[model samples]
Target chain A: MLEYVLSKYNFWTYAILLIIGLYAMVGKKNLVKKLIGMNIFQSAVILFYISIGVKKGGATVPIFLGDAHAAHGHEIIIDAAHYFIPLPHVLMLTAIVVSVATTGVALAVLILIYKRYKTLEMDEIMKIRQDTGA
Target chain B: MIWQLDVIFCLFVIICAIAAINVKDLLAAVIILGAYSFFMCILWTEMGAVDVAFTEASVGAGVGTVLFIAAVNKTKRRSKD
Candidate 1:
C-alpha cells in the first residue's frame, strides 16, 4: 500500500490542482480571474503530459548519450523507455505560445470593455448591456 | 525513492495556487499567480521537462503576469467580490 501510494502521489497533486482551476473558472465573477484559472488548468495538463514521459530510472533526456557506441556517428531514437518522450514537449511548446497569445488578446478586449463600460465587474457589465442594448 | 523533494515542492505549488486565486487584490493575485508559475516551473524541471519549464518560467511568470497587470491597470484594480 505504501509503494502504491508513493508511486501515484503526483497524480493526486495534479488532480487537486485540476479541481481548483475548474472551480476558479466556474465560480469566479471576474473575467481576468477566469483567464488566470484557464492558465492554471493548462499548466496542470502540461505537467501531467511531461510526467508521463518519465520512467523508473531508465531514461535520460532526449539527447545523444555518448560517442563510443553511437552508430553512423549519430544517435538513433529509441523506444520510450530509454529516453524521455519528446512528443509532449513539442506539443506544449505550441500550447504555451497559444496561451500567451490568447492572454494578450483577451486583455486587449478587456481593456476595450472597461473603456466603454467604465466597470470591470461581470455583473455590472451584464446589467449595463441589458440597459444599453449594445 | 527520494520522493521527499517532490512532495515538498508539490505542497508549495498547491499553496501558491490557492493563494493566487483567493487574494482579494487583483495586483496581488496576479503576482501570486506568477509565483505559482515559478514554483510549477521548477517542479517541471525536476520532472525532466526542461522545455516546458522554460516556457512556463518565461511566458507564464513573465509575459502572462505583465499582461494581467496591464489589463488591471486599464480597468479597475478592485474586484467586487
Candidate 2:
C-alpha cells in the first residue's frame, strides 16, 4: 500500500498544498494575513506547473550533444527538445517576478493604511470611521 | 531515501488548515495561515519543484507571514469563529 502511495506522490503533494493555501486565504479576517494566504495559493499553482514539467529518468532540456548513446543514435536539432517540456520554467520565471512585485505593492498599501488610521486593528479603524461620520 | 515522511507532512498540512479555519481567535487564524504556507513549502519540495519551493518558502512563508501579522495588528481580534 505504501508503495502504491509513493507512485503518485506529486499529485498528492499538490492537493495538500493547494488546500492549505485556500484555507488560509479564505478563513482569515486580517487583510495582511489574507494576502499571505494569497501568496501561498499562488505558490501552490506555481508548484503545480513545475510538477507538470518533471520527467522520470530524463535530463534537463538543453541543446547539447549529451551522452555517447545520444550522440550515436540521436539527431541534433537547433531547437532544443527533451523528455520534459521547458515551457513551465519560462512561465514560472515571469510569475515569480510578478508575485514579488505584488507583495511589495501590498506592503506599501499597508503602510499607507497605518499612517492614515494610526492603528492597525480593523475594528478600531471601523469604529473611528463610524465616529467621524465620513 | 523513502517518501513516507512526505506523506505524513502532507497530512499534517491538511490538519493545520482545518484547525486554522476552526480556531475562534482571529490572531490564531492569522498564525495558522502562516503555518499553512510553511507546509506548502514542504509539499512543493516533495513534488520536485525545488525552484518553486524556494520561491514559495521565501515569499509565502516569510513575506506572507509578516503581511498577515501586520494586517491582524490593524484589525480586531474577534472573528465570527
Candidate 3:
C-alpha cells in the first residue's frame, strides 16, 4: 500500500495543482482575475509537459558532437534518449508563438473597446451602449 | 497505477466546464472557461500527449485568457449577476 501511494504521489500532486488552477479560472469574475487564472492554467500545462518529458536516468535528445564542418568532425547519431519525448518541445515552441500573436490581437481589440466605451466594466458598458443605441 | 485519478480529474474538469457556462457573471463565466482549458491541458498530459498539452497551455490558458479579459475589460463584468 505504501509503495503504491508513494509511486502515485506525483500524479496526485500534479492533478491537484492542475485542478487548483482550473478552479481559480472558473470561479473568478474580474477580468484581470480571469487573466491571472488563465496564466496559472497555462503554467500548469507547461509543468505537466515538462514533467512528462522527464525520465529516470535519461539523457537529453539532440546530442551535439564535434563541429560538423571540422576537418575531423565526428558523426553523431542522435537517439531517442529514453522515453522522454522531444515532440512536446517542438509543439511548445509553436504554441508560444501563437499565444504571443493572440495576446497582441487581444490587446488591440481591448484598446478599441476602451476607445468606444470609455469603461472596463462589462455591465456598465452594456448599459451605456444600450442607452445610446450604439 | 490506479486509473481512478483520471476519473477524479475528469470530474473536476466537468465541474469547471459547467461553472464556466452556467455562471451568471459574464466575467466569471470567462474565467471558468479559462479553467476549462487548464483542466483540459492536464487531461492531455495524462494521456501522454505532451505536445498537445503544451499547445493548449499556451494558447488556451495564456493567449485565450488574455483575450477574454481584454474583451471583458472593454465591455462589462456581469450580464445578469
Q: TM-score: which candidate is best?
A: 1
lDDT (CA) per prediction:
0.83, 0.66, 0.60
RMSD of each: 2.4, 5.7, 8.9
Model 3 TM-score, 2 decimals: 0.48
Q: Which docking category, incorrect, acceptable, medium or high, applies to candidate 1?
A: medium
Rank list by lDDT: 1, 2, 3
lDDT, residue B39, model 1: 90
Off by over 4 Å in 2: A1-9, A57-82, B1-5, B9-81
- What tens digits encode model 1's per-residue C-alpha lDDT throughout A1-134? 98887778788788988888898889988877877788888888877887787776767677656565645667565576777887888898798889889989989998898889888778888999999897
Could you tell me the C-alpha RMSD of candidate 3 in Å?
8.9
Question: 2 or 3: which has the higher lDDT?
Answer: 2
| Residue-pair clashes per candidate | 0, 8, 7
Residue B14 displacement in candidate 2 (angstroms): 4.9
Every candidate's fraction of true contacts kept comes to 0.71, 0.21, 0.12
- Most DockQ-accurate candidate: 1
Higher-DockQ candidate among 2 and 3? 2
